[model samples]
Target: MNRLTTACLLTPALLAAPACALDPQPVNIQGLQFYPSLLLGERYDDNYREAAYAAPSSWITTLEPRLRLVAEDRNSAYRLTYAGAQQTYHDDSSASHLDHRLLLEGILEFTARHRLTLKAGYSRLEETASTAIPGVNDEYSLRTFGATYRFGAETARNNLEFAANHERLRFHDDSLVNAREERDASRLGVTWFHRIGGTRALIETRYEDFDYVQPDSPLNSHNLALLTGAVWEASAKTSGRIRAGYQRKEYDDDGRDGLESPMWEIGLDWEPRSYSRFSLTTRQAYDEGDDGADAIKQTRTRLDWRHEWSERLSSTLFVGAARLRYQGLDREDDLSSAGLTLTYQPRRWLELALGYSHWDNDSTVDRERFQRNLYTLTATGSL
Candidate 1:
């Protein structure tokens, strides 16, 4: 009867269920906002590389196009997005590929709590290589800028926030995984909130900095964190955000050795009825390692379920797990996954989906142990 008293006695039957209509409803012009999408898919993979021995299987065909644009007012907001893809493989034609992404995001609310946020992105990817080397086609670019300030007001019961952020990452192939890890990251934070009936209690402190571009890279790092958190919403039929922390990572390379961990992030959401819904997530982190490990300490968990068995049927389920550790290598990895999806939205812009997934990896190095299975079929439209 623990687990926070069984999640506070199941939060009133998960907030009296009912909420799920998974997004998508946009299209307007003149006030500018649009969402256009098209996807057609087919996939089957029983293990394409991810090998522990003779494993190669494939059948793929996918075409995707997506777009989103938005514009807002009153304070300011804007967004732009695009996604493109084309994949074909039939006998694993060199793992056929073409992918692209573009994004821009913004927000500026100069007053009513002050804010500014902006992001930029570009991507082109194709990857597979969890250690047996060989697999690449990556291009990346990203930028972010942020600022926020808020303090008391708007029905304040003590609230405060201060944030700062800067990020940059770029890589355009630097000799196939040996030195293409460019990076720059920065963060500074402060938060404090208290209001305890219907919950909201938070405390945070953060500082992070990472800079690298092969400066004799051992993944130069710095991190410091401290957190304590809570956020709950009951009448909304359950809501969650949880944090717990103490993290420290420092390395300026002396043959790598610096870490002090115990960090966590958790999330939960529930809607016990009215077409069912449930979600849970967890994390513990320290990452920046892509097979040339010098850092990677991860723990992840996830669970999700959704159901809407009428008005055009729906279903979803997923489960996940992960654990990896390697920071100067003694290597360990374990991963597991499960998935299911079924959807049919007979109208309102149509959609059809079917999916299945399974993956397993357990390694202590053995060609990175592997197992995989995936099947998918999809169709979507909305313009």
Candidate 2:
């Protein structure tokens, strides 16, 4: 839906929807619980357009209203959600837009050992000026469907999971008609887990196929990855997973170079105190390139710390760095970013947050380089 439709549906809901049920609780409708919420935010962006020179600043306002319906029984759980975010720029109307998403998911456990999970989602999203030609906003829609099945329960000695997913991407802007950006991608993967005391030793195999609708889709390719990982779930103070693997991506056009790279991912969380936590994550992976390259290899790492100062106040700090190596192109980029946020909840159903973030990007292509800072104030209300 567009901004008008979203606004029309959101106005009355924000004012009266929560009053439908009287007990300060979710309303019961058709055997499911209904939850409604709204978020309002105001932001000041120093570089809203992501310009490399003569950057302009703007004040932005965002409104989002969401509703969720959920049902759960002994054997199964199901949920449905819809959300729309509309953004308006005080100085740049051309940069304003509305984004909408819908999602549905269900989990079914027939027995203690067999479980099936399914999900599907659709998003009408916009690619802001950063990904476009500096002045254009690229619009696209995505539809995704996926399912996963597990063969063993938590206490079992071994577990097996089978997963499959498909995605369809379509561009809406006429400026992208010849860009050949529309495509379909499918992935199939399986993992085998062997329990080793408090940890699990695992191996995974994945295959992916990409298809483009444009004639002579030179970027069409098949990819494969073999990975081995270890999982140590929540324990006394620490939990995390590490995986190392190799991936090979071959393209349909022999003239264009392919990518064969080593990949690894690490994630860990430590709770040193009852009111504090620290998290670290790192990843090296490949993403399909739309910037005149076959693919891009990205490496990044981040660290975050969260502490609760009081029963109703909390703060978080984070820093990150990344590098991008574009395959089939001589361009490279280094990126650094940091952010801090403070949140307070004076009441159970209301929350407020203030945040500030900064980004610095250095690219071999001059047009892609920029530095930006943003400040925001946000509030959320729910019933």
Please report, in order, the local distance difference test score of every candidate based on alpha carbons.
0.72, 0.81
TM-score of 1: 0.32
All candidates: TM-score: 0.32, 0.92
Model 1 lDDT tens row, 122-224: 5555543342244443444455555666666535677888888666666555554545356777888998988888788899899888887765776788888
Least well predicted 10-residue stretch by lDDT in candidate 1: 1-10
Q: Quote the positional error of residue 173 for candidate 2 in Å.
A: 0.8
Locate the minimum summed-lDDT window of 10 residues in model 2.
1-10
Runs of candidate 1 exceeding 4 Å displacement: 1-51, 54-195, 200-225, 249-256, 260-262, 270-273, 278-280, 286-296, 299-303, 308-316, 319-325, 330-336, 341-357, 360-366, 373-383
Cα error, candidate 2, residue 100 (Å): 0.2
Tens digits of per-residue lDDT, candidate 2, 229-260, equal 99996587899998889988988888866788
The lDDT of model 1 is 0.72
Best-matching candidate per lDDT? 2
